[model samples]
Target: MRRPVPVFLPALLLALTVLGIVTVRLVVYEFGGPTARRKAVTVPPVDGVRITSMTVYSGRLPPCPEPAFDDYGHHDDPVIRPLPTGGPGISATYELHNEDTEVFTYTIRFMFLAGTIQVGAFTDEVVRSVRPGATVRGTVRPETQDPYTCPVTRVKVAEVTKVPDSELPPPPERCPPSGLRLTSDHTAAMGLRVVGLHLQNCGTDDYTLDGYPLLELLDTDRSPVDGARITHGSGGVSGISLPGSGFDEPAHPLVLKPGESAVSELAWRTDTPIVPYLRVRTQPDAAPVTLTLRLDLGTTGTLAVSPWKLPP
Candidate 1:
């Protein structure tokens, strides 16, 4: 009788242990929540605010498409001023701050509200792009006005955000008008001469060009002309002068959204006839772009802007 009691107690304990294991498994495996992992990423911060303080928002000239008037004695002319003020109307500026994991480019525009009538409000379609972790500034003003005034009344930021891809707007199909063929302290033409390459945002967005090309005239032998110089009269080449003079013109750096292009000009002259190729090198921040231009004596012509294709 004693041996049977001990056997029965051991059997009962084993059965109880098995039952407890089954109950715990059912509760944990079938009823518990899910367990999955995800990757993490960080993004920077950006801020834009309306500037009511008149002191900081002083007016200035908007950037020109091209400073080098490559095309001379051609039908190419700067976009004439339409308003009573003689230009795109107003001058405005905005402050932009970029905060993010990677470097970024921010584009901003201001719209003028004049008694509910918006007249001649323009954005920086070509010449301004901000970088990441930096503050960017932009201006909008009439090109042809004296004492250049800011025509807009109320200024609002058109866009203040970061773009993922580098490409914004593609270069426009129509070449941007290279401003005046001449850049002298004196003046003759009544209006502004639009210059530089224009790009379009065909890619459904906008982008910016680093800057205008630093044009160096190459001789027939494909070498940079050491002493060759360019000169222009008050009214441009239209009011000419001597030979072999080089005009040291600055290319206007600009930003273009989709359907936009950077426009610039090359107003230069040489004593010797220049049928040689015009070698173009873009700014440092931009990709190295080079192009061969065909020069025709006695004619100021427009140079078209295209992407630089490097060989593999």
Candidate 2:
């Protein structure tokens, strides 16, 4: 019995030694393994740059001309252009002076408000190089609902690296009017007259559209309507998303392939005066398409526009 006790004691000691070695190896692997090595690596902080001054232009800015009416229609009502409500497509520009010593790219975000409610946001990037001590400008056009008031609330530096001398991408080729077609359909619901603008790409190449189409009301003689103010979107109404439509999101560039079609919504009041014709320009410089559809814009001269969306 005494001899067996000695043998058993030696076996017990050997098992305990192996257990301790295994536990130590596990502890070291957990504390100094790949995860620990990853934690040790750190990214250097980006030095903050300064924006010396920011000037916001509230009303209709340049590149967008004021309403011009040609004398063609007879009417007793005084024609007044729609008042400016800054949002996605509303023409507003921001002038920013970079105070930093280094060149950087920036993005400007606008907040549209109706009293305390935040109705919409318009964001745009400045693609041109903004050298230190230089002034660069960007435009804010709400592609969605036109809020009653829009103010520049935030500026973020999207990238802090050096901007290339030729940073601007080549401008896209304009789509010819022959390759595209515009048609409209209207429906009356809930006291609002909604007109759907259907744009079809019949050309060989794809066509892209950004922001709202340039809209002008023309009389029977193809002359512009006087005092007709065209405002974009349901005035001051938010959360209007055209379901299953790309325009339901923020205003961004949309591309239509050959044989593909996209739709946009134009909404006005029901009791408004009727315009005999509508002229739409897809791009700023593209040829205008004269539409003969009868449009009723309410008394406010405001029009609500939805983003361009693919039909379901």
Candidate 3:
């Protein structure tokens, strides 16, 4: 039989057991265990910022949507600015409230709705100097004319990104007019004279053209002809498409490479006095080129030009 256990042995064993329990509790708390869960429950949730009120108005004109709000307290019918005959401008104002305690820089984008098309304009980054529980006002106005048929129905906040100064990609460079050439072919059908304006790329690099070429009629004295106007269309020619292009749509921008060519339709009445020369510039700022061709513009004194595209 063993001798009686020492008194110190029992006390040492009890101390070690208590130390092991303490170590386990510390490990669990450090690793997000029960204690961490209890701490998380007591923490408060974060409150963000929002736009409280928005309004659109122009100089002295009645606000769009008439009443501007609904019974339920939301923006109701869209605002339609009557098409401006002159340059009466349009503008929008927004009231923003920051509910949280943090300072932030914000950006606001406006989407102007015109029929089915939506156009967007934006403001620069605005720093909110006001503290939380305070409100600030921001404004946006369109710089360019609307391209769609419908007037702006209402303005919308497209983006409310929270940043002071965001970086944007650089604007694209306009294509240069190098190694480009212009020529034309004339044909008369159904009492209308049509001239196919052919543009060829004779240089190594590609050339692009959009809309209609700048055109003018010149007399034998090399002076611009008075009272001659030019418009755009195929003059009711059905089934007329660019050669090998298989497209019969309106004029659009086109790209051409070496030896590649595109064509545009130009039509005028045959009864008018004949001009001995034609002047064409690929774009508004480009140098004009003169071609000697006999074109009779008739009493209407107008020329209809179609968009350039690949020949059918």
- TM per candidate: 0.26, 0.39, 0.38
Q: Candidate 3, after superposition: displacement of residue 219 in Å?
A: 2.0
CA displacement after TM-score superposition, residue 205 of candidate 3 (Å): 1.2
lDDT value for model 1: 0.35
Largest TM-score belongs to which candidate? Answer: 2
For residues 23-102, could you state the per-residue lDDT of candidate 1 as single tens digits?
Answer: 11111111122111111112222244343211111123232222234356445545532213322223444445555444
Best by lDDT: 3
Candidate 1 Cα outliers beyond 4 Å, as residue runs: 1-90, 125-129, 142-152, 165-312
Sorting all predicted structures by TM-score, with the top scorer first, yields 2, 3, 1
Global local distance difference test of model 2: 0.52
Error of 3 at 78 (Å): 86
Runs in model 2 lying further than 4 Å from the true structure: 1-177, 237-248, 298-300
| Candidate 3 lDDT over residue span 160-200, tens digit each | 43421111111123222446666677888876677777777
Name the Cα RMSD for model 2: 27.2
Q: Give the better candidate number (1 or 2) by TM-score.
A: 2
lDDT of each: 0.35, 0.52, 0.54
Error of 3 at 104 (Å): 69
